[model samples]
Target: MDDLLAQFVIEAAELTQQAAEDLLALDCEPGNRARLDSAFRAIHTLKGSVGLFDLAPMQGALHSAEDLLDLAIKDNVELDPTRIDPILAVLEWIDRCVQHLQRVGTLPPTAEDEGAKLVLWLASGRAVTPAPSPVAGGTLPQWAAKLFDANPAIHRNGAVALRYTPAPECFFSGDDPISLMAGVPELVFARISTRENWRDPAEFDPFRSNLIFEAISMAKRADIEAIFRLIPDQIAIAHDATTDPSELPAESHETTTRTIRVDLARIDDIVGLVGELLTAKNGMSALVTQAQLLDGGLALSRNVAALQQDIGRLVAQLQRAATDVRMVPLGDTLRRLSRLVREISGQTGKPLQLVVTGGEIEADKTIVDGLYEPLLHIIRNAVDHGIEPEEQRQIAGKPAKGTISVSARQVGHRIELAVGDDGRGIELGHIRSTALARGLISAEAAAALGESDCLELLFAPGFSTSETVSDLSGRGVGMDAVRSSVRRLGGKVTISSAVGTGTTIVLSLPTSFAMSRVILVTVAGEQYGVPMESIAETVRIPASAITQVRSNEAFALRDRTIPILRLGDIVGSGAPGRSEEMLLVLEIGASALGLVVDGIGERFETLLRPPAGLLRAVRGILGTTVLGDGRIIMVLDLEALLA
Candidate 1:
């Protein structure tokens, strides 16, 4: 294997991965032009690159895939969920092949054999066969032999030279450029350069596209033709060895583009700068407060204050920019699920249609990556447990084909993603019985819990409602993994189900690790801080309006009475003033109570950092907040309060 062949193999695998992902999106977004184009291009890219390697099997498979995808893109063939599984199977095969090559210096098993089957499957109904290779025998530059082959020569502007630029992602084919250059014809002079300039040697990858080329008598035309042949925009051949000689028409060459890869360490540098700006903004604020307290205020101090204000604005902008660095579109992980749905539906003989909404939603890159498995689990569960059988659905007055809808929405400082399905909902009694049998709950407790509560118990590990397990989903369970994933992100998951109606699972996660939230209330004759998310609502009651209920003081709210909890008692904050204290109705889960305080207050927002060690173990309070008035208020954690 030569360098170009090695590069081709690596690039082909990547293209297959991309094509599989694109195929998955087609079912969710019917007639999606971008996905269609992407799938076609990925296949074309792989087919073109694989020509350099002697892997005829992989090449044939990619050719078939490219032809099929092209047909769909051009509206020649219908794009349906049925068409995606074979593509995924092929992609998975290619993935395995690459893994084997990584472990051993040879292509895994018979990749071409599997690839050939996939190609034939895609092209079965098409009247036209796949296009013939532009090049054969090797990835020779255009002038050498077949059109697609690398190291092939080209003719451009009447000048010819052997030309080939290894893929930015190459070297997986098990080839070395040093030895590859030695094999090419008319070897005159050779030059090498990677896609990026090396600022640090340690960051450089020796095989990751350090493009090498040797040209001689190298008809300047041959080089130009080779460059123009492999890629229309990437190469050029001129009268002299001048970089980027205007060999092609300026109109077309000007449109050429380049991509750069930056290490994550560089991004962290920007985030660090943002942190410093925040710290500086805080320091300036502290300094200004001291200046105001000084006995004599200098005139120059006022100018310095104005400068500080400008810096404060600059810092705010910097902070927003830094945070934006973490935001990435969610389309990434969700794109390949269509393939999974198609394959599983085939195996189970169930018609599954995946509907996606708000795929354009963007969030922290880390969050998007974390969402893949959770999202997959929900989709799978919906198919297995949420959706009813065809006959059962017809009896329930539903369409024969069940619909599974996945949606993502931005809510406050959080993103809420939901997966819903039209199916026979959870059988509440079965869950209660299962819990009892598992020793997870006593008979009395099971009897006491509501139907919804019993359904929620399915999130426990090793719980499964499916009878006579199937390979698709009845292998123990997966919802527990879903809950665990969301929880690890400091998020929560909730499920709602109605028998013979439908089911919905919602995952709520913060946009970032920590953020600002404040709820204003009075305590100890002064205003205090509480997170707004912690407060369910507030009730105003006059001193004489309150009445006793069940031997305890309670307040009537919308015809429902709630227990009262005095803030002074909970925090030992001196005592409520003689005047009637305002009752703030706090709610979490099934628990709702009122906090009696000195007076009502205005709400505000501020970032709250979790305290260290055991302090974080305190359940009721989330974090402390500093108000505009410089008062420290404790932000209550309503989730903790209820749990």
Candidate 2:
């Protein structure tokens, strides 16, 4: 990606997101001039930027979209809810094309045809076309039936249908029939077929040009004719054209300093360097220890320690600045998702209102970027499965329009995002039955489970209460996928539902993955770190306090029996028994576990580098970090270790 193309990709994505958002808003408040203007500007700016590259298809499609919006703004055409479909479709198409351009260095081969359809639709004022006749009549030709069947969206309002049959030897005369049809103005749809009767495979010729081209365009007859001027004697055109039926408060703004855009990769590099500096700072502890053994040790060590403290303060400041630089508000993700919500609502024919709050909460860029897909799957399921139909809702004493709320908040060093829907909540009985039918659990187990346990079944792989599959969801992938995605980012997902009320899925994740707070512990003289967040508390009990429970050792803490495990044994480094037991009480979800260690060390915050080399395959190791004594220790992924 050259600098120009890279810049184009970024700008194109931003512009498309903005345009889609504005268009969605315009769809609801068709009378809002502000949103209308913003959408038009976004499309216009996008069109101009697209012209800089060899993306005529995208450029033309965007141009047509711009014209349509311009008509709405000038009151030449009413911007109804349905009329915005073509513009939205065009934006989505452009976004897809832009992604392909960024990844493959060129537009897709079908771009021209797709763009033409969008252009024609826009030209027709995006009218809702009637269903094609069941039988071919005098007005509808047999060829058009096939064309309409293949491209159902081809607008018939004021549409010109053209059929072209080039001479058999036309291919040898430097003529391209497909390219000619692509050049037709306002071309909506086209089809290619063999001009003559079928021939056997053994007798087929390699090249003879026995093909016919049929297309539907919104352009006038003369414009369509000009496209095939050289082969006028070989084409027929028909006209079936008909007349087509075609936000908020201002917040006070204070002047702020100008800002410059910086590439994310550069910031990541700075963060990496900062982590190295932290490691170097930790290495100084060894120097301080060594200096204590010198002749004037006491005084020398004190001075060096003082210097180390000063560097530590500066390092802390640097870490704060770097982390802040990586922080991005959740609003960006939510705004992008707003488009998906609207699209789902339209497709399902279930009116929906998206309510979002606490978008100002910021988190690491990695978390924000990875959050999109999981949230997408959840929202799709919410609409397709959770939300009921209009009649059902009305009968259930609920509003005709469903509401999906996405809210974010900061709790301690973590961020919690909740996606809730006011719809038909998950039925625990249904989940139990599905689990049994799928052979995920035995009838006895399902019968013994409680509400909370039954709810957990929703996250099980291939678990779904939906009886039928739709494009949006079903086949049991949605919730399971959400759980997997959230877990990959070191997050926890939980679901809560009330019969006849609604359902809410909450995701709890760390604010940043670059740094972590862990309590150092030693197992068989090998130092390790456990995330402090997972530790409920540290406890020391007499060896006699442990009791054997069936096949596992257990301990009593706060009147609750918690399983106790030797960390050394779990890590394959068993240690000898001691008079007293040292334990780190870990709270994972609703279960408590006591992890036995040799000794407890200091609690420290440090940059955590992901496991690499041989440690990458280690299941219980979350990452690795440098200790103050200059030794590298593995950080335990308590969840994975315990599981």
Candidate 3:
């Protein structure tokens, strides 16, 4: 029963989100009947599902919403723009109820009243009026009145009256209808009767279920619904609201497939096991290397090396398969943003269009989940501060409607997600002035800063260019939070803007948080790991091949000069070697830099563990990993090192 309830919560949450997406889409493409049908179906299914839990309030609200949608479907009434808010309000209420149930194991005390108000408002297509009071000594059934009179507390709080009629062939469906009603929480009254007149003893079919079960329960409507969720079509629920809500009509299905729902903890366990397997594989590789070094001419050593290679291949395949299970397409997150854009656009009275591309790119589930808030902040900022008002946009020779383009794509081993707008770009001068005024940067420093450096000030804590605080922006926190979040994910955030064109913020993040492919390099006497994705090329250059430009050393590659920094000096490992040094070219945004190392080692994939203790605050080190030879290798953060 707990598992069933959990599943219901998950399904209901998804349905609500889908309904919101479909409704928003239907509003945009009013002629798209498919979207309209989808919206209706989502609400209809939600209504049916809520009925099983005996959540009177939720069922009533959804039932009214489903009816309205049904009417719209039948009468071909274009969804009135006014109706959208109420429809969304209904979904929001359901979401809240589900959350409440999840937290406290039952709906809130006001759920029934709140649901009734929303339903009344929806049904009237306007504000809800006060419902008339129920008559004293009302036409209550004898059983109901007796039960209530006996338990005054139940009567005062109200009770859910239930009538359950198991299907004639319900036995074949493995339903024990009597046990279902018997299990109703806080059951106050129960009565059983035959659905039809009794037949001859011999004529009675043992398999046919003719019992009609009725009961009254002090338990909340949601509890009653949950008790009968599996057989919703076989039950009826009534609460003591001013008016009785009707039951959801049942639909029959000829086939059903069972699904094994595994808890997220189980999935995390699998990922952990896979990580251990990767570490073990690394140890095996190191053993093979050691064996070859000790017996280079032995056939057994050669055969063992070949076997290690095959094992490495299989390990890589298994790691990928495990990682893939934890990945989900970005489409779900993008759709949520789409709905957000619509709501914000409506509220701000700015005609805006959200153009999403490459949403099909897959990302780690954990990463994607954490992205919502950061993306929300960016989108809100774009709508509120980036996009100009329609009149202003038209005067600027731009279209009346502004466009916010959100795109995601997998680039090498990193995922690049960019949010850009076709509106007024950020002003560098204003940002510099704001930074200086906020004491984030010195006046002289602000004055001498280039455009890119000035733009970076936007991410400084408590720095904003807005003259006044409004519903959005001016809080001096959004961009800073975005930067912090991306940094925590081992990602970087970059911004590009033109004075009047628009601003684009791009986030580059590793494709997998659990494991990564890295190139091992020996610096001085210590070995370090550099993310393979950051390395553009590796070349061995003679000491004299490097040219000194002023106080900095640089090297020319393909007619372009890149500044070079020695890894040993940067990491404080040791002095640089006089021999020909291996240099790794790293691409950082639009620029490239060269890092001088002692020598390059083989590239391999390894699980990345978070830094511990004092190393957590260390900027240039990403994480630590144990190599096969029991050596701990520090993964270098190329971005931070370059910074």
Candidate 4:
């Protein structure tokens, strides 16, 4: 029973997301009848499922929403923005109810009142009468008729005719057909017979199941469906059969398949084990290297190296398998933002259109979950601050409706997501003056700042150009939070804008948080890792190749001047290496930087573990990893270090 409840929660959450997506699509493309039907089915399924549990409030709310959608479908009623909010409200309330049920196995006390209000609000807009109950005492089948006649006084409000044929190997799969049929609520009659003729006793196979179970129940259709939801393919249901039982359709032969809903803790445990496996594999490789250095261990090293290579391959495969389980499509996350855009646009009285692309790209679930708030902040900022009013847009020779596009794509081993708007771009002069007036930057410094530098000030704490605080902007906390959250996930966010064109904010994040491929390098005689996604190229430079640009050390690479930083000096390890040094060129947004390191090592995938205690507060380091030879290496935060 507990397992069933857990599965219900997972399915309900998925259905809620689907329903939300359909609702948003329906709003955008009102003529899309298929979307309307899909949304209605999702709500109807949710209502039936919730009815099986003790969640009456959820059932009631969903029932009303379903009825409202039915009216839209049957009567072709056009749903305006005002009518859409109540339906969305019902979804939001359902989400809350699901959360409460997950935590306490029951709905909250206030759910009843809140649900009543939502139902009332929905019903006030459309004339929705409750569906009539199934007709009482419908015609029974020949097999059930005899049993009913024998009793005569047994009153049944509804009749469910079920034909269940257990699979031949169902016994091995932990199925007890008789026990399942016995648990049916209000069971009035049942007959069990063999699907196939019985064989001779000597040839009989007790392990195989060939039973055909037929039953009649007075329970509601929803209740009956719930009882057999897990194995629907094995059963055929006829509700309040106003016809002969023989007229029922054959049971679906398709096998019932399901996804296992493992606890998140269990997945985390598996990830942790994979991390340890990777560490151990690397340790074995290190030992093989050490063995090869010994005089008489060469032969042994060769054999061990072969074994180590095989193990490494297996570990890599395991890592990928584990990560894939956590990957979710970006569409799920973006669908949520659609609702926010609608609400904010309505509140600000600004007409806006949201366009999304590359939503099929997949990323780690953890990263996708963390993105909700930061993306919300960015989208809100775009609608409220970036987009110009309709009149202003038309006067500027632009369309009356503003467009905000959110897109995602896989960039090598990283995920690049951008939220942009075709609206009046940021005003650099206004930002410079605001920064100077707010004391965020000195007047002299503000005057000398470039466009990119001026844009950076937007992320500064409490830096906003708005003269007054409103519901959306002026608190001056949105961008800063976005930067903080992105950085915490080992990613970077950058903003680019043109004077009158538009603005785009891009986020580059690792494809997964559990593991990453990094290039190992030695800085100040200590080993460190730089994410491979950030590395552009590696070159060995002579001492004479270095140039001094004002007070900064830089060099020309591919006709572009790139700044150089000594890794030893930045981490306080030691002085730069010899006259000839290995330089790692890193791409950070639109700029490139060269890091002078003592030596560059091989690149390999490794698990990233979070820092603890004081290490968490440290900058320039994303996390730590255990190397093959048991050496602990710090993963450098290239973006933060350069910032």
Candidate 5:
């Protein structure tokens, strides 16, 4: 795709998102003038951008939305929930059009009908259609005022103001835009300007139309439209009523933040390059050690060590910068989900409010993107099953409106994002019944399980409490998918609930999935890595300290008897007989276990690529990382092993 089209996709998506958020906010507080104006400007700007392409349907829909917002802001029309919904629907339609354009290089075939429906919905409040009609003879447009200011000889009174922006490819269509403008009846003055910045002289293409024609005509609006009949979408006609530019309808001017849109794949490539650089940096340490073994190498080794130190510092900075680039604020994702909540609420006829907090907390782009699907499923379930009906809520002494809240916070190198709702919480009895009915859990097992244990069953594949199938929830595949997705991102999912209060699910995820700190250890002469986050500490204990308890081993440390598991035995490698045993105390959630290894080596931060191919089916392995010597070592998933 061309650069302009690609940029339009990105920017159109952003504009629709902003407008959706602003409209949602307006739905709650109709009197918020700032939000109203912001929504108006976003839609207006998006319309202008859409006008530059062959997206006439999108332009028409957005034009109607902008007109509605303008009426609301100027004529003091109350933007209640009724008006906000259609505007949001239009934005959603535009977003879909943008996505289709990105995928197929043009709008979908249904764009015309969809845009028309949305335009009709937006224009339902007024008698006029989506197209621009003749303005009353009292207020001149801003563009017309500028045209008169530039050309002092032009007659301003009762002149029809026209701004014609021919399509870039109009020249190839055998249409002379200049000739069409010359045919305008009683044309008095005209000004031609470059539509955009001129390209490099050598690379410029004369075949592309790059001019915008602004003219004042004594002809009627109908006569001007007849002249530009073939390209009605590219022309705008208004009656020049008043000389004062201030008399025109006011539009909010926003100070835009300078930013650039980058492809996520590019950032991932940069991260991969940084990982390779880290591997090369690690090799320098091995070089320094090898230098010391040669004759008269003491001085050489010292210089090499100093140089390695400098290079190490630089590599660390580069690593940090690369990781920072991969980090993105969760606010955008949360806002998008908030839009989803609004949609689900509308579909279910459930009055709901979404409150988001700590949206500024940053996480890896992968994590943020992966979060949407799981979160969407959760939000659907929340709206469909969790939130009780309005009448039921009233009888239960609860508010008629249900509230769903999503909050995030950072703890060390992990992010704790909790999605909660003020609705009917999951019932333990219902969960047990559903599990039993689906044969997910035995009756005996259900009786022995505690509250948390029963909640965990919710994430079991094909385990759901919905009795009937619908567009939302029903055939299972909700929480289970949530768990799988979170686990794939090196994250954990947990749920807590109060019988009649609400349910809150917390997802603990690594801040960056690319790089991880692992403690290198040797088990049965083969090197392996254990994630540092799961380890409490490393301790040296004598063999005699291990005690047998009912055919199981336990070790005492600081007045606590932790269960012991040999890494060699777990990996099918025979236990190594040693006088002193090295134990890594692992703390995973509420369980603590001691993992005995053959030897513990240096701690290193390296890229932990997810398992692929046959390795993906293997259990108890998180991922693989490359060592300085180019050997691939397996990073053990201690939690998986313990489970």
Candidate 6:
């Protein structure tokens, strides 16, 4: 296989897998002509690409499937559930063939040689199409051979698909999936989706290629053909069902519907451009308003309001587009964890199964993807350390096979994912001893720590109860990594375990990646955000109310002494700034902290990306949120700043 063709083959495998998964989803409601068309195009593209490289096996199978699908669509062929298994079997065939080719120079011997068998099986999958009678003389006519040439030069499918199936054992080797994308021959567009389910990255074996791709193109089938041709069995193809004009209403109907199917990435690009435009318009309009006041008095101000109204409309549209791009089912993440639990049960010799609930909940896709790794680590750690072995469970009078239940629910604007397992829970004593020995906590503190306080130490670095290390799950042995990942992703993870019962790991993640209603406060001359969530209320307390208790400054309210952390004192003001009347009363956990600040400011929303380089070194700043007015406000790292 030539380099380009080989690459295409590799890409096609992934895209095809993705295409299959997506199509299967639209199996019901065959009325979704748009979806059906998209699925068909993916398969058709694959078949066309196979022909380019003279890949007989893959091309043959895909061509057969595409023809059946095409026929079905023209006459409303059912996306019968029974067809899914066989189709997946075909995809598996493609995967196996691709793996073999990647390892060796040649295609391995298989059913590909049995063309009669493939035709027989494919024919059975569809409505009975009359087979032409066999010719008496079994010789191809010269003219017929020329007519039936593999490279017919007709690109039937206008769109493409990219598929990925993380190997069942992919979790054993860590492979950070960027997505199911491939540089294929005649590419129109590509999407990345998973097959089966996701395994924990720690368990995903990188050595194995579990991801598959399906690309669509009518220009050339060369790229995918070379890579996928060798391993024909592991890949499958069909024509794009979406582009079939025979199905959709004419172009005239486009304007009547308020919504149109759009690629998410395109929407993301539009959101960014619109955001920049919104910012530029804001600055320009402000300048114009100022100029009008100086030059023409009230003339430009009249038009300025109109411009601002236009900007608001644009901003609203931008948000709708972005949200559409970011929205994804919570099930995507939960399904992955469910798969991980099954793998863990097998790996740890613990008889456990995951019972998943409420997966249909929706959340931002960015948060969902970032969450996969952290959730995986916590669950695996629970199995490895939180759960007892089958023998131990039996001795405890519990069922030999344990159960881990994962659930997701949308409460207000945030989504919560809980992983609960019925197994041996943590021993706080072990944690206390471990924390003290490791010097993470002093012996005095360990002795005074309550069970809940000591148990939290497990989230600290190097705090694991596993006596012996196994190779199945990695660095997650120290759950501090999980904590860090969660914090970085704008989420939090907490564990509650009852001795001799079970453990539940709950992760709270935001539904919005970036918001527009952030209230800003200044701490020690520097600005910060209290996440509106952790804010109870900001009150200006009398300076005389502040009193010292046990050498720590405090304020008493409602018979409660809340710890006072002068924002200027803890965050230093170049020099001890003047004491202020207002205190930012923030509640975290079970305690309250009063942070004195130089001033309180207006509230606005902005996109907050992680600080880079020097800014990251600054303490107590989770991230910086940009305001529509162009000011950047640092977000107070609540845990570090207050805890």
lDDT of each: 0.62, 0.79, 0.76, 0.77, 0.79, 0.62
lDDT of 1 by residue, 1-643 (tens): 3333444445655576578778888878767888888888887877666565566776676666666677776775557566676565556555545433432335644455456566656555321222211111112233332221333344322323444555555467554545545654454445555545665687877657666453543433433343333342234332221223343223122211121234656765676566555545555655666777777755545766887889877876776776677776666566557777887678766787888777677786667889887877787788887787777778889888888888889898788888899888777898888888878789999999886567668876777777657676766556777876676465778888888788899989887643454667677766556666656777667766577777667777888777776776666666743546477787643457876777667654344544447656775666665544455566665444433
User: Could you say which candidate leads in TM-score?
Assistant: 4
User: How far does residue 93 in candidate 4 sit from its true spot (Å)?
Assistant: 19
Ten residues in sequence with the least summed lDDT for candidate 1: 131-140
Model 4, residue 596: distance off in Å is 2.0
Q: How many backbone clashes are present in model 1?
A: 37
Q: What TM-score does structure 1 among the candidates reach?
A: 0.50
Query: What lDDT does candidate 3 reach at residue 331?
Result: 73
**lDDT by residue for model 2 (437-501), tens:** 99999999999878887888887777877888888886457677887678767788999998888
**Global local distance difference test of model 5:** 0.79
lDDT of candidate 2 at residue 173, scale 0 to 100: 88
Q: Could you tell me how far off, in angstroms, the CA of residue 376 lies in candidate 3 after the best superposition?
A: 2.7
Clashes of each: 37, 2, 5, 2, 0, 57
Order of the predicted models by TM-score, top scorer first:
4, 2, 5, 6, 3, 1
Residues 1-643, model 5: lDDT tens digits = 5555765777887798799899999888888889999999899889988987998998988888888888888888667567677787677667656654653466666677667777776767432333212112234457867877777776665567889999999998898989898788888888899978899999899999999999888765556766776675677666653343342322001101123567878877887777877888888888788899999998999999898889878887887788888788887588688678878888888899998998888898888988888888888888877899999999999999999999999998899999998889999989998999999889999887788878888887788788777677764567888877787788888899997899998999988875689989999999999999889999999999999899888999999989999999989997765888999999755457899999999899898877878998999889888888888899998777766
Model 6 spans > 4 angstroms off: 1-116, 119-268, 277-310, 442-452, 467-477, 528-530, 547-552, 569-574, 577-581, 589-591, 612-621, 640-643
Write candidate 6's Cα lDDT for 55-82 as tens digits.
5776676776677667768988666555
Q: How big is the RMSD of model 1? A: 17.3
**How many angstroms is residue 24 displaced in model 5 relative to the true structure, after the best TM-score fit?**
37
Candidate 3's TM-score: 0.56
Worst lDDT run of 10 residues, candidate 6, spans 131-140
Worst 10 residues of 2 by lDDT: 247-256
Supply the TM-score for candidate 2.
Answer: 0.59
